[model samples]
Target chain A: GIQVEQSPPDLILQEGANSTLRCNFSDSVNNLQWFHQNPWGQLINLFYIPSGTKQNGRLSATTVATERYSLLYISSSQTTDSGVYFCAVESRNSGNTPLVFGKGTRLSVIA
Target chain B: GAGVSQSPRYKVAKRGQDVALRCDPISGHVSLFWYQQALGQGPEFLTYFQNEAQLDKSGLPSDRFFAERPEGSVSTLKIQRTQQEDSAVYLCASSRRQGNTEAFFGQGTRLTVV
Candidate 1:
């Protein structure tokens, strides 16, 4: 089993500010993804990065598989972005594997 | 469907009762997963299914927890003799591929065992 750890357990940012969230995994992974759990408890998919960089609107993510880490960047933060951001990874295994998620970084964007 | 859909968004059950949670993945999805998330905690894997087959269930916390996807389109997670510890948010996800792919998650069902 692979372990995932997220940094900055809590974060508060002003509207329009930028922030970076980090996720470190213990073992090599087949793929990784970023998710946002909204205030209503809905899990929203953010990004799916296995070993590269991807950008979606104001949010972007980069995964360095060899080093076993992934970073999620949020620019021009909005109050709507206030929620828990999670990093989940699928361990490289022969069988169908599930994503193991980190505790997550709770982000609060104040307008 | 537009995305993964879970039924009975919230449920409350007695300590010794049985509870069943249902999840409907997106159409054409080949992989489905079930996970549990305690308050303020990340989601933990519970089971995985590929089509109608229950491929991996090693993450199930105990034997009392069981899941089924007989038709491979819908899934149901049943907790027998529920305990307080069984109270949590149950999440379901689906992906088009089997090994490596992005999984779309449902809103989740919040269960409370009193």
Candidate 2:
């Protein structure tokens, strides 16, 4: 089984500030996704970047597959962005298996 | 029709009771998954189904936990003789394909076994 590690276990940012969350995996992965779990317990998909980079609004993510690491960037953070950010991965050995998630980065953006 | 939907957003069960959680995946989606998340913890895989056949269930913690997807559309997870440790959020997610696709998650069912 692959181990997923997320950095900055907790983060507090002022509105409009920028922050970077990182995820490191112990093994190669075929699928990688970033998710945001809101206060109400809704898990929203942010990015599905197995490799390369992707941008969605003020949020962007980059995955360096070779290095087994990924980064999520949030710019001009808003109060609505406050939540637990999870990074999950599917390894080559676990075909068609469910993803393994990291503990997550808890972000709190104060207005 | 729009996305994965789970029933009974919250449930409280007496210890030793049986509970069933339902999940309706997006129409036409082929892969469905069940996960458990404890308070302040990330979601952990529980089981997976591809259509009507369960391809993987190695994540299930005990034999008391079982899941099924008949007709390949809707799925149900049943926990028998639930214990306090079963208190957690049960999340259901579905993807269009079985491999290399983004999964859409349901809001999840928060279960508390007292």
Candidate 3:
């Protein structure tokens, strides 16, 4: 099974600040996604970037498949952005295997 | 239509008792997955289903855990002889295809085995 590791286990940022979260995987993956678990426990899909970069409003993500790493960026952070950000991956060799998740980066944006 | 929906937003069961959780994936979705997340921990895979077939269940923690998706749409996860260690949030997610793809998750059922 592949292992996913997230960095900056905890982060606190003021409104309008910018921050970056990272995820590293132990093996090559065919699928990679970033999710935001809101305060109410809804896991919102943020990005599905197996490779390259993608942006959605104030959030963006980049996955370097060759390096086995991915990054999530938040610009002009808001109180609404406070929650847990998770990175999950599914390995190519593992057929129909569920996605492996990282411990996650807990972000708190204070207004 | 709705995204993945889970019933019994929360459940409290006595030790050694059995519990069942339900999940309704998005309409027309072909794949479903179940995961467990302990407090302050990341979600761990429990099982996966492609349509009505359970293709992988290697992540199930023990024999006490079982899941089913007989109609390829609605799914259920049952835990037998529950223990305190089984207390966690049970999350259900679904994707459109069988291979690698984006998954939509439900709000999850928070179960507490007392």
Candidate 4:
């Protein structure tokens, strides 16, 4: 089984600030996604970057497949961004594998 | 539906009781997944179904937990003789493809076993 680890388990930032979250996986992955869990417990899809970079609004993500790591960046964050951000991946070496998630980075954007 | 939809957004059950949670995935989705998330923790995979076939259930915690997708569009996760430890948010997700693709998740069912 592949191990997914996220860094900065807890993060607090003032509104309008920028932040970066990191996720490291122990093995090769065929699919990787970033999700933001809102206060209502809805997992909102942020990005689907198995590899390469993508940007949507104030959020962006980059995955280095060869290095087995992914980075999510949030710029000019707002108070509504407070919640948990998760990185999940599906191992490429496995057969019919489900996404494995890291403990996640709890983010708090304060005004 | 525009996205994955889960039924009974919240549920409470006494110990030893049985409960069933339902999930209606996006139409035409080829893959469906069930995950369990404890408070302040990320979701953990429980099972994977590809077109009505349960492929990997290795993540299921115990034999008491069962899931099925008979028609490939709807899925149900049933827990029998539930214990307090079974209290958690059960999340369902669906993807358009089987191996590699982006997944959309439902709001999830928060289950509390007393």
Per-residue lDDT tens digits for candidate 1, residues A1-111, read 789999999999999999999999998899899999999899999998999999999999999999999999999999999999999998996356689899999999998
- In the predicted model 4, the residue pairs found to clash are none
**Which residue ranges in model 3 land beyond 4 Å of their true spot?**
none
Residue-level lDDT of model 4, residues B1-114, one tens digit each, is: 899999999999999999999999999999999999999889999999999899889999999999999988899999999999999999999999887899999999999998
lDDT to native, each model: 0.94, 0.95, 0.94, 0.95
Clashing pairs in 3: none
**Prediction 3 global C-alpha lDDT:** 0.94
Better by TM-score, candidate 4 or 3: 4
Ranking by DockQ: 4, 1, 2, 3
Better of 1 and 3 by TM-score: 3
User: Could you give the DockQ of candidate 1?
Assistant: 0.88
C-alpha lDDT (0 to 100) for residue B10 of candidate 4: 99
Deviation in angstroms for B23 in model 4?
A: 0.3
Question: Model 1 lDDT vs. the true structure?
Answer: 0.94
Q: Model 3: what is its DockQ? A: 0.86
Residue B51: error of model 4 in Å? 1.0
Mark the 10 consecutive residues where model 1 chain B has the least summed lDDT.
B97-106
- What total of clashing residue pairs does each candidate reach? 0, 0, 0, 0
Instruction: Tell me the tens digit of each residue's lDDT in model 2 across A23-46.
Output: 999988889999999999999999
Candidate 1 chain A worst ten-residue window by lDDT: A90-99
Write model 3 residue lDDT over A19-101, tens digit each, in one string.
99999998889899999999888899999999999999999999999999999999999999999999999998766677889
Judged by DockQ cut-offs, is candidate 1 incorrect, acceptable, medium or high?
high
Docking category of candidate 2: high
What does the TM-score come to for chain B in model 2?
0.99
